[model samples]
Target chain A: MLGVLGGMGPLASAEFMRRLTLLTPAERDQDHIPAVLWSDPRVPDRTAARLGGGEDPLPALLRGIRGLEAAGCGAIAIPCNTVHGWFEAMQAATPLPILHIVDAAAAELARLGVPRGRIGVMGTAGTLAMRLYQQRLEGRGYECLVPTETEMARLVTPGIAEVKANRVAEAHAPLAESARALAARGARAVVLGCTEIPLGIAAGPPLPFPVCDTIDALARAAIGWARGA
Target chain B: MLGVLGGMGPLASAEFMRRLTLLTPAERDQDHIPAVLWSDPRVPDRTAARLGGGEDPLPALLRGIRGLEAAGCGAIAIPCNTVHGWFEAMQAATPLPILHIVDAAAAELARLGVPRGRIGVMGTAGTLAMRLYQQRLEGRGYECLVPTETEMARLVTPGIAEVKANRVAEAHAPLAESARALAARGARAVVLGCTEIPLGIAAGPPLPFPVCDTIDALARAAIGWARGA
Candidate 1:
């Protein structure tokens, strides 16, 4: 069984489950992956905690991890990218193989036939500050492109805010504009590093260049694990 | 937190989760209801068990209920219809309020303003044989319409099987045909008693007759409980 540690924002997590179902090549209900979604909205904000502006979310994150482990899950997937900032600590706390969002994105980049050119990584300030995608993808031989501070302040941050508020339609233009900025900067492909960003991008028209959605990427990873298990 | 006792057909339960978030009126992430989904497909088939053809699923159902209670869920929603055949035992085993799919459908009927007419009930053989919806809705001043055994074997049954197999597109024609047959027999509205039926119906073009989806109805009930609590 797969455990989804979610509700970093509720809708993104729900969309993850939906995508997980659609992406699985199942012939019957029994053939589909069995999952337990520990969706507690009370977990403190992952970005705020990482930025030193709020209470630590590690305890709550650990609680969800323990709960899923107790529920008999073999492995776990966290849909929210910002939460991956605590990946090492949470993974240490649980014996379950907690899938790394950045690793999944790296695999997706390879799957899309994207090579060592500049790759745009879009996500929360915490993810950027901690160098979640940049460090890993750079080590994997891909140069990373990120939003400028001005762009983050005016576009990327608030666009994510809109998605979290369930006003997904309103989030599209700003998010798309930020991605367009990356594409103009000569990015090979932009990764929707945040789970909510994919929902936002999907609300509007398509992006002109290739974009990797970590939500779908993570779902694919979980499905791969389920199929193999 | 709301508890979803699901996986009686994994896709149906996942759709219930998707609808739960979409149906909730929220401005921010926290405004959406907190939910824990226990989607274990290993529970023996409900219809087979009720027909005395398989192992009783009561133990597994009870286990899921207990797990949700331990996880701090206040109320529970079981999306699958045939499982409600054991609703009494399950409810008796747990103090938490288990939302009834039939009651939700009945409320949806009132909400849709379909009052005191012949209502069609479509579901698995266990649900129809047990008269789950008919007994309750008929007691509330509505006559019940049901598909004949011929219709069940040829149309409704096969259609539901298609949905369970995740070939939702293939399920549409036969399920819609069964509903049309009911409408022709003077049913005022058709009730999609089984959770899988709605998925099948929605996959096809819109039905000309009024039909109630128990999955959405159940989600609404769960949302209402979360709000009021």
Candidate 2:
């Protein structure tokens, strides 16, 4: 069975599960894949941890990973994009196959035949700072573009915050503006690197460039892995 | 930490977690209650099993409960209302505190101070057949009203099935009709005894009397227990 190591923000985790269900080919409950979710929201903030200003989320993340493994999960997926900053560490710590959100996004980009230049990335400060998307996509011969520091600080971060606070409607304008800015900067396609950004942007107007939601990518990857196994 | 014995229908389980997060007063992740969710959608159909034509869900339910207990959850909450038909048996097999969904609904009824007679109940055929809501509320001095056999077969059952099939919008009309019928039959308040009912009915016209959502009531009860502990 697959496991979800979640609750980076509870709603995102919940949304991921909902997407997983919607993506599965099932007519009844039994036809769907089984999953174990360890939703311990107490894990410290990923942005704070990555910035060296708050408690590290590693210990809590490891605890959740172990809990899912103990429940007999054969593979695991962490839905939060920012937490993918510690992808290598989490992978080394667990023998089980770990589905990386960034890798999934990169794979999706390749599958969609998004050209190898100027792919936009939008997410939390921690995700951009760690170069999670850049490192993964660049190694695949793609250049990544991100919102300006001012936009990240003023628009992207607050947009994600609004979603976490359950004010999804309020987050749309800023997120749309940021997406527009990234596309105007010559980004061929934009990756919604944060989970909350998808929810906010989904309710708003459509973007000019192709948008890839990491949450959907990760959920699709997990479903494919589970179904294949 | 609380353990969620879920995936009796996966979306309902996800909704319960979403509600748990929303009901909590936490401004940050750490202040919210921690939960371990085993969303094994492969569990045999509760309605089919209880009716004696399908595989029993007891073994799977027991396994989920034990998995959570092994993970160090102090109490367990099963989000599905129909599963409470086996609450006593589940509680007897495990030492962990098991939160009862019906009791939570009854408590909400009392808290709302609705006069104790002719409370309408709508849910899966199995939950009504077992009198899961009736016994608990009747003990507290409230009479129960369920859809007539024709209504159950024609409107209520199909409406619930539609929601489970993710056709929530289509379920609205039939469910609203059921609620109106119950109210016209002298039901002072209608208890959405099934978790799916709330999702289906939310989009429909407002009911004539007060509506009690068992899923929300159960989530509130679980949060209260987790927080108080």
Candidate 3:
């Protein structure tokens, strides 16, 4: 069975689970995939930890991974993008296979056969600072386009905050603007690197480029792993 | 930490987690509750088993409960109402404290100062046949009002099926009609006995009586237990 280490933000964790159900080809309950989720919302902030402004989330994340491991989970999926910065440490801490979210997104981009040019990425300030997506995708011969430091500080960060605060309606404008900015910079397609951004901009107005939801890619990959595909 | 054994229907499980975030008085991620959720959608059908038409869900439930116990969860919460029919068995299977969903709903009624004449209960056929909510609430001196046999077979059961099929919008009408029927029979307040019922009827038209969501009550109780309150 697969394990989900989540609640970096609770809604995203929930959405990921919902997506798993939708993605499964099950008519009855027993036909669907089996998963154990450690949704410890009390884990320290990922972005804050990355920026060296808060407690490191590694200890809490380890606790969750260990919990899943003890539960006999064979694989682990962490839904948050920023937390992937600590993916190597988390992976080394446990024997179970850990599915990286950025890798899932990058793989999705590759699967789409998009040319290796500018790919838009939007997420927490820490994600950008840590170059999580850029690092992952650039290795795959893709250039990453991100919001300007001013745009990120002013628009993207607050937009993510709005989603975390459950103000999803208020988040749409800023997130749309950020996506537009990335598209204006010649982005071929936008990768919603952060979990919360998808909650706001999932299906509203159409953007100039296709959208790649990391959660969707991760969920599909986790399902594939759970099903031993 | 609390262990949530869920995915009787995946969406209900997700809703329960979302409710945990909303009920908690936290401004940041670290301030919210910590929980391990085992959302094994592959668990045998609770309602079908109770009706003697499917595989018994007890072994799977025990496996999940044992998993939580091994993971060091101090207490457990199962979001599905029908599963509570096996509450005693589950509690005995694991040494961990198992919080009963019906008991939480009953406690919420008492806390709200609602008189004990007629409490409408709507859930799966097995939940109603097993008289899960009826027995629990009646023991607390509250009369339990259920849908008629025809209503249960026709409106209530199909509505629940619609929700499990992820047709929540189509579920609204039949569930609302069921609520009206219960209200017509002198139901003081409706206990959305099943988790899916609330997801369908939570928004739409206002019901004749105040609706008490068992999932909400269970979430609050689980949070209290987790926090040592």
Which candidate gets the maximum DockQ versus the true structure? 2
Candidate 3 scores a C-alpha RMSD against the true structure in Å of: 2.5
By TM-score, the best candidate is: 2
Q: Which ten residues in a row have the lowest lDDT in candidate 3 chain B?
A: B25-34
Q: Estimate each model's TM-score.
A: 0.94, 0.95, 0.92
Task: Give the clashing pairs for model 3.
Answer: none
lDDT (Cα, tens digit) per residue for candidate 2, span B80-189? 88888889999999999999998888878777778487789998889999988888888778889999999999999898877677677998999989998999999888
lDDT tens digits, residues A19-105, model 3? 887787765666767788888888888888878789988998998888888888889998899999998998888888899998788
**lDDT by residue for model 1 (B1-229), tens:** 8999988888888889878877877766667788899988878878888776788999999989988998888999999999999999999999999999999998998887897788888999889989898877888899989999999999998998888777889999999999999999998899999999999999878988789999999999998898789
* Each model's total of backbone clashes: 0, 0, 0
Q: Could you tell which candidate, 1 or 3, scores higher by TM-score?
A: 1
Per-model B-chain TM-score: 0.98, 0.96, 0.96
- DockQ scores of all models, one per candidate: 0.62, 0.65, 0.59
Task: Give every candidate's TM-score on chain A.
Answer: 0.98, 0.96, 0.96
| Model 1 chain B poorest ten-residue lDDT run | B22-31
Compared with the true structure, model 3 gives a TM-score of 0.92
Better of 1 and 3 by DockQ: 1
Give lDDT tens digits, candidate 1, residues A1-229: 8999988788788888878887877766676788999997778888788887798889988988888988889999999999888888998898999989888888888888896778898999989999988777777689998999999999999999888777889999999999999999999899999999999999988987889999999999999888878
The alpha-carbon lDDT assigned to residue A12 of candidate 3 equals 82
